[model samples]
Target: MTKPTLYLHIGAGKSGSSSIQAALARCAVPLREQGFLVPGDKLEPDATVSGHQLWFFQGLPKDEPESQKKVLRRLLRCKNAMAEQECHSLVVSAENLINRRKFPDLFLDVDKHFRVVVIAYLRRQDQYIQAHWQQWGFKSHPDFDDWIANGLGDIANWDVALADWEAAAFKKQIIVRTFERPKLHGNDVVLDFFNILGLDGKTFDLGNTEQNRGFSELTLRIAERNRDLFDGPHDNRFFAFLGEHLGSVVYEKEGGSIHLGKEDRQRLLDRFRAGNERLRKTYFPDQETLFDESNLPDRLELSEAEWSQREHDLIWRLLFAMHRRK
Candidate 1:
């Protein structure tokens, strides 16, 4: 027997990857009872439960190519170990496996284990670009506009991402989840994926949506403290510690909207309009036949003040009390 295996949960930029991973980690025991080992190698029922890959970038020396490669090697070893163990299922989650200047060792390592199907839930491009910017800003990556400015030339092209995935033998399972549909209503988005795997319906109870209702005060605090990239890696202890604390406030931030200016927003929307069309033609030929992008929010931006609130700490405490740390 080939042994039941799957290499999935690849994501498009920032569509609830953290939330999904965190939820799965939270539901580890119950899900395992149904026969799915979220992170097969952990040997525990938990998914490679904590930490985000982008956090590692906070530890890299900006100008050092050798240093970049070294950290990636470390990332790959950890991901590979998680994938190789014998189990009914396994999942690896990371956003940069697509965009960055290059991929981490996890890409190659994932290839060796199972037939990989890339699960990328795409929102319209305009929203994606804006959300990416909000993230950079929240993480203290210079002025928010600066990151968007640099995203022009190659960044406008999402197809390049498809090409990169092709190199790793990954097939795209791009589910264009619209903003209107589930609005990520609750566990629907997650349960949909679970059903794709043919798992039983023991459904997950999603926690409060308020705590993650934007980046939160905690994230803003860290970004403020670690604003300089060049000065970052030297503060590994700071980043690691702050990161754990920040993790608490990372639930989905509901309301608030970012204003990326009409011109800039339209320009990005146009790019995604064109780019998404190309994605349909070049990759997912029959987009209409595949998935709909119409309802997916055109732009899911996090307004500036959304991250400025101090009330987040109190909310974080409450969230931890209800959910507790894993």
Candidate 2:
């Protein structure tokens, strides 16, 4: 019997991972009928949010030996079940898996059972850093300079992050997709992913599920100022509430915002230029460039007075909105 193929969507986050996961969860049954198994539907039936997060969690270094064994057993059981059902492919997606430097070690025992294909979406470093900072760094570091200076920029280095997988024993193929809209098939990550799976995306329900929108500039500045108050596990709740209430207000007023200036964007792109070029040549030789740079934002320089006025107005509006909500 031919071994079932296992596709791992190891993410470079700030890409549209959440939406893809949600889509997979939503279409689990239909996909199974088509001989593709989303393991979370079987392994984690009661999970509120889907995707094989438990698989990744159990594979972590901190997990107990017994717990790891349990997950592995469950995975084997899933494979057996898939075989019985004649499912030829299993897709496990988790954005955090990109950070696992020793990625092959996690699947060493199971590589023989499946042809493992690793898939990742690479976003431009400048946009990735800005989105990542807004999503996570603003809570702790607040200042973009401080956050980037702390070596967080290294996360965007796809060549380094994927080196272990490139040379792993489980290497069936590595599919690297550009995260830029123009580059993606159908200008959508979900559609691009379905295309990768050899499925017509229009066949699926493809609900209007948008996930993880970044905070606006005004909200980010306020969150930065109040970073000290967000020093707990529930900080995400606070950020979500602020974003839910105030994210649109700034957008309505300012049209759109650009977090990185032209020079900063250029500097970041330059820092990763060599690695990115190597990646482009290795994975996508047909493409002229790894990422399109034609539409990059021009320089943005805000005067102190302008910043203060924007902040003051945003705060007053926030206060009024809160009162109205009550």
How do all models score by TM-score?
0.59, 0.86
lDDT of 2 by residue, 204-262 (tens): 99796566666566666667677776765236776666666766664442323445777
- Compute the lDDT of residue 223 as modeled in candidate 2: 70
Q: For this target, which candidate reaches the highest lDDT against the unseen true structure?
A: 2
Q: What is the C-alpha RMSD of each candidate to the true structure, in Å?
A: 7.9, 3.1
Give the alpha-carbon lDDT of every model. 0.49, 0.74
Q: What is the lDDT, from 0 to 100, of the residue 99 in candidate 2? A: 70
* Count of backbone clashes, every candidate in sequence: 10, 0
The local lDDT score (0 to 100) that residue 145 gets in candidate 1 is 61
Error of 2 at 191 (Å): 0.7
